[model samples]
Target: MQPKKKIYIALKFIIPAIIFLISIGFVSKKQEEKLCKKIVITIENQQGNFFINEGDIMDKVTKNGREMVVNLPFDNVKLKDIEQRIEALKFVQSAQVYRDLQGNMLIDAVQARPIARVFNPVGKDYYISDRGEILPVSERFTARVMVLSGSFFRPYLEKNLLIDQAGKDLFNFIQFIEKDKFWSAQFAQLEVNKSGMINIYPQVTKQIIEFGSVADYSEKLSKLKIFYDKILPDRGWNRYERVNLQFKDQIICE
Candidate 1:
């Protein structure tokens, strides 16, 4: 082919490509300039927890008694800022914010699941999330979870409880009960004494479970399970006033 013909073919393709690129940029700029017309908030409550509601999330996204994203331009709406504001709520585990092509802002939030409710001796009450996050008790809702009460957990009210080994052990012990179907239903509360010994209370039974410290919790629980499965069936649930699993290779019942 001749040099002029070759140049003509190259220009034909390059010119259209440049035009398409510019058209895309212009459309994107127009989209950004458009005003947000609507806001949609969705709260995921698969766990049936009502700690936070739609109104609470809207309050966080609103400023000065107005919705931040509704009347603002797409470019001015900070999605990350909105997300951070929603996630700041004690019950919200995570939040996501974004804009749709229809000039509407959408927010999706997941609420935290409380594994245990802790009532300290100093009158500080809180909830411990499954991820070890300390959450404040909500006046609107109460979770049906295991309870923890005692002076041993009082120091954690003012500081990060999950940072220390003792705290971690306590959290792990709660997790163990929460994970087990039978134990979670049987046990209602765990009390830590001054000497760091743990006593568990059952919902149906009248006996106290002297679970000792958090050390060897798995083995202790195993023994307790055996007692329930084998001994309780024959001796009856109320046969013993207290069941001690602190001893090695022996279950002391009284």
Candidate 2:
């Protein structure tokens, strides 16, 4: 009976001490949370859109972000607001905001990818992104993609918007050329007129290529490839001033 009584008394004191320790830990955690320290901002360069910098991102965040993030507790930080503000930047394609275990703000972002550059008829220039949206030209970097000039212009509600259907068709046609190794290196410039006639200037040969319309594009490209592989080598590339691939089953050398 004596041993059992001692054991019960020991357990009572140990349990109270344990409860006090737990309460102390909980209070420490709450106190640490209330102390909002430095405003740490991290911006990830996912797609290499070098138009904007980390300072630019933090400026956007602090200017329009929730004051709770910088002044109040870390738990009061508005993550979605930060994300939306960052994504609203002209070059930012997407952005995500979160807090780490140490209450540091982390942001992961991707920049818009430009696939083509368009020189409008009205003497304006912009980039066409892979997602088909129009992007403003960056002062930092220039992409060595396909360039379209002349009267190939499409109306848009805003400058930084997707190309219209007709413009997309033309853009896709240029994309096809860019994807092909031979044509990409050979075709330097693409020009289209108001009548929808397409002309291609090659880097290798002096002959102008009259591509006409986008109709029968695949067939026309196939024929051009055949001429490059079989006929151009034999007949000499300079023999023809112009190569017409507009017709269905004929390669007219003028």
Q: What lDDT does the true structure give each of the candidates?
A: 0.86, 0.75
Error of 2 at 152 (Å): 2.2
The candidate scoring highest on TM-score is 1
- For each candidate in turn, the TM-score is 0.83, 0.77
lDDT of 1 by residue, 28-120 (tens): 878654878888988885387789888888888885357666768877777898899999888899999988887788899998888998886
lDDT of 2 by residue, 1-254 (tens): 69999999999999999999999999988767555455565445435546777877877778734344554575566779878988998778888887666756777777777766778756568877766677878777777877776665556313533345666677677768767887789887788876668998888798899999887789999999988998899999798899999988999888
RMSD of each: 6.9, 4.4
Best by lDDT: 1
Off by over 4 Å in 2: 1-25, 30-49, 64-72, 121-123, 154-163
Total residue pair clashes for candidate 2: 0
